[model samples]
Target chain A: MEIEIERNLVMPGDVVPCPTGSMPGYGTYQNEVGEIVSNVMGYPAMYNRLVCVNSLRGCYIGETGNVVIGRISQVGNKRWKVDIGASQEAALQLSSIDLPTGEHRIRSEEDQLHMREYFNHNDLLSAEVQSKSQEGKAINLQTRSSKFGKLKNGMLVVVSPNLVARMRQHFCQLNNEVDIIFGRNGWIWVYYNNTNELEVPLIRRQQIVRISCLLKLMNKALVMISPEKIQQVFERTSDIELEDLLAESTLERIKDIDAVE
Target chain B: MTEEILFYGFRQDGRRPGELRQIKIKLGVVDNSSGSALFQIGHTSVLAFIHGPKQTKHEKESGHIHCYFNTAYFSSSGERRKFSKGDKKSNEFEANVRTMFESVVLMENNPHSDIDIHVLVLADDGSVECAAINAITLSLIHAGVPLKDFLVSCSSGFYSGMPLIDLTYSESTSFQVISEYRVAVLGKSLQIAYLNYDDIGGHKLTPEVVREITAMAIEGCKQVHFIMKQELQNACSN
Candidate 1:
């Protein structure tokens, strides 16, 4: 018997169980009987557990609390307006800038933050969505952390915004080293081939296969270039040098592909 | 690659005088876009996405059909550069695309609507515009946009006194043995979208060279149309 998720059970970065009993969540793996919660759909609500489930969610959209990559469209009074793959522009206030506390005290429109000093038009940036409004058109953003800031000197690749959510759910764990931003409006900003930042958690390889499976399903709904293609593209075009491990992995994939044929 | 031989009766990439690069096309990759397709010939990879058939955003005329063709060219380093908003290159491309598409698209079906085509070149080894047209046609078909016929394009250059099928970046940028043509063929009739020549100043290409290149491009155009047809059949059936 197969079980289907009536709702979204997990976000991208979440860890689930493996049925083989060797991986995380295997201890609590439920096979025969399960309880469904109101907000949730399936069983084994633990830090790490295995349960058969289905995900029936609407089309992925960008939202606050999500880290996104955007292009600075304009600079204005103490704030920067960015096109975060959203229908409406998101505002990044000067106050949201994470400057050292001891270095600066007083804040003024021109004195605290000069528009050109931070980001210029057409500059790609990595930021976090801070908030949204009643109309749902307006968005606030922040770049206070070291990880969040202008993405200078990098190649920015944008894909269909709808794929952003799916990509983001499995972010930072791709076999290929890269940084990605899942914009709400189905736009994905990928900084190709960033080896320094791509720390493949043990969980990532597991999720990658899952992503591949979902992508296969999506391929039926619409004609698509698979995630593997995108990953290959990043590896091919990335500015970073291919480490030995990465090169070996690529060779393995190439061999596997050839072997299948 | 060295030692250009004139009247050699052989072209680079092992083609007999006049031949075209192999073409592979897949339509409707991006769902949100009404129409989309990926075109590949050799190492050149281009993706074209078509949106619209909606009401015209530009207020030219109430029922006049509008077609916008925007192209993104990616360099060898993988850096992408777009044409200016209303620059000369864009104006020329837009005019050619408008004219070429208007000829085939049944604009009268939806007089007041618009069709916007965005061609994104993931890798531009050479013949960017020609590949773009092939991809766009498939995308439009996938989007179910009504059309009178397929508008196809291909590039040819005079190299070693022999017409090359599709010039690679090195060959295109080198301007060696150079009389290039951007020929658009629709069934029996042919239209020249843009033509450029280098090195041979004030001298017209020989009639033989022109004929050979035109025939090669038209043949390639037919292949492109075939691919577009199959892609449409697949998309519709699915």
Candidate 2:
């Protein structure tokens, strides 16, 4: 079967170029006259009978099973509020997280009082979106797996959330040197290694910093970021110094975009 | 009072009756704000910044719109007065702008948040509100805030029995406008969103004058929207 891809820029109040019977999807609304109109500025696309506009600069909207990186903003009763750069702070219920010892047991009353010890304010962590709240727009996050927990010795870099493509595996090891988590909320965390944070090799540290810089450079150029693009940029920019990685010349050269058209 | 406001069917600045001042728009000037734009028309300039949908102290069923209108002390020539934050004129103008955008933005979509629009008049020759409205519209687009339509605004007035569009400071005040009107509209549909005017030259408010001036203002807004759309497309294409 052949696939078709057609995209045209449309802003708010612009009528969508869709068949008269198609239903409107995200980033669009049907008027009283039943004509589909775009409510955001973006590229309108058709999927089956639904038409949606992929907005250019919109903030991240949540989805189930997606990974996110966030900082603990507040500790409340039976829950922790996290700043994931979304419309509302996500909630991590006391019962949804795994204890530090990897033991799978019921969360007792003590856990509610000692919530700060598990994830205090300003502590960064990675988790998967479990669900959205019933009455509100808040997202519910879970850290049931060993892979999701407090992130240390890693620096966070934020870009446009849409630039981070959805992939099967968000956690990846780059060149066997650094661990990268591409959060759907545009927060990227890169660390050398989970076990060895107190002492680090000089070369590994430079590589980790370089990856963060490259992510920022791609963001400035409005290019989509994926692991394949990262590896491609890494292999191509071998001659450039770490400090010069984000220079205008370097950004212009590595912009052979593969994913974002 | 014998100064010739119009010489040879041209305004003092050499623009014809229907002609608008040269417009220049620049987006994303403020890195921190979600959206920001600077709009310049003739010598009048306004900078607008959109900050949120951010968490506020109180959450509601719909988002709240806040407008802060500030005129920099140096914005207007020959006026060295400090525009205090609570100036009654500024407060009224700010409320009018806020209400203008509240009708255009899709507030129901952004539940439990605050969208703050801060408009700064960097230079004032005439029609700062029109420039501010244009700047805020561009800023909202840049921020990707959902809107019903682009809210484009323009000011016009009657000069010596002949109607003029996009009146300058001198044309509005010095030339003794027979009538002056400011309008904000949904550009694509030409639906009037807000309207206010004053006729100080003692000209009778006739239906003919109203129709003619309104058509002129709508035309001005359409021209502005066209220019903005073109610039935005070109800016992102490369």
Candidate 3:
């Protein structure tokens, strides 16, 4: 878009070149003299009367109801501390998760003892941010939804959080071969669609690996990833061998692809 | 007033009293880290990076910062010597860096987070502290950390009855240059974030000398800021 070309770039602490009357918005703060200043390195754009800085890169800060994928780092008393690519570990309380039978029951001491059976250390899982503590220190996440739970037999591809654009649906099924979850926290998971199979089929596994590699390439080039962009890339690189796609020469070519188009 | 310190109004290295050395910088050098920068001024090279806003042992109201500053064995201009972390001078410099950035960084924005800072002085001609500060500031910007303004620094020395800006290793350690001032200022605001005065020869601390040297150092900071701004713009364009 022409508008993107005009977006004024600002580094941390730079004064936004906006009008004096504009209100400070996300990634920006008003100084004592009342001028809007950027708090991060990025372009400053106006959302109505509020001037906000669209940061190009930073740690993930999840809001309420946002779906995120994280690794369980610590199994504590009745809670699992998840490293969700945020500044702090997100808390997955025992009460926030549903049992396998989908029954809502009060947590007994037995459940606390069996917490490891549910989610152990270093286990990756998907959950929704439920709420935050008053100080915003403790991030509470819930895995009550049917699709939100432990992830196994999958490949995880991590990109910068900013590269994944917010979409109406983050989950996509590609050609009935693989399932992709574009976690808002930049953790992309490509797993087999068939849950019953303990081992992934060779074809599906190849597709999963290819998809993850493409995602990494897009992220390295600072391109925003969306379902449409993924389809285009799959079409473009279909002929190249999967191992050769990540070569330095191919990466250079891919970086300049937009210009050729 | 030593004749050898400055030969006919030009220093040994052939730089004017007001001139700074050539600076080269590259951002995001350490891809694994959240943010990293390699900053070189003259022969002084420092690599600075930050990791976290991640897990911490204890919780706090705002982001907690930890700084690690070290110098390589071959960093010094003279005979190579290991500048271990326990060295008094390096320890003091680390504390000064952390305290200076505490106010500049908007820590409250990332409450209950831990920010780790690591800086290694690969080569030290002079003004290693100033170089470290500038490197950290650039990497912080690369990481998109919140800050009131860019924290830039410069070292100035009072010698030969004149103020010398951006001192080199020989100029800084010369017996004739009795006192040196290292100042870090906030970009645009022109406020001093850090001021370090070293009296190597037991020189008396005078108000006039302080004012003059700090003024020269602040001017140096502005020049440093100009160069850093250009680097940032180039990174964005790419």
Predictions: Cα RMSD each = 17.4, 2.4, 2.9
Q: Which regions of candidate 2 deviate over 4 angstroms?
A: A1-6, A134-136, A201-203, B59-61, B198-207
> Native contact fraction of candidate 3?
0.78
Task: Pick the winner on DockQ between candidates 1 and 2.
Answer: 2
Task: List pairs with backbone clashes in candidate 2.
Answer: none
Model 3: DockQ vs. true structure: 0.68
DockQ of each: 0.01, 0.71, 0.68
Candidate 2 local lDDT, B1-238, one digit each (tens) = 5567788999999999999999998988998888899999999999999988676655445567899988899988655778746898689878888788888888767677788999999998888888989999999998988888899999988766787889887777653675458898897888998888865566676798888889889999899889888887876666
Give all TM-scores, in the order shown. 0.44, 0.93, 0.92
lDDT agreement of model 2 with the native: 0.84
TM-score of the second chain, cand. 1: 0.78
Query: TM-score of predicted model 1?
Result: 0.44
Top of the candidates by TM-score: 2
- Per-residue lDDT tens digits for candidate 1, residues B1-238, read 3434333565445555465667777765786775678998767877887766654543234433344544444444244565534667556776777777776665654454567777666677777778877777667655555444456777777665556667655556553556456666653234543344343323467888778777666666666656655554444443
Interface RMSD of each: 18.2, 1.1, 1.3
Tell me the whole-model lDDT of each prediction, alpha carbons only.
0.54, 0.84, 0.85
DockQ sort, best first? 2, 3, 1
lDDT of 3 by residue, B58-148 (tens): 6554567889988888788978885568788878988887788888888877767778899999998989889999999999988878888
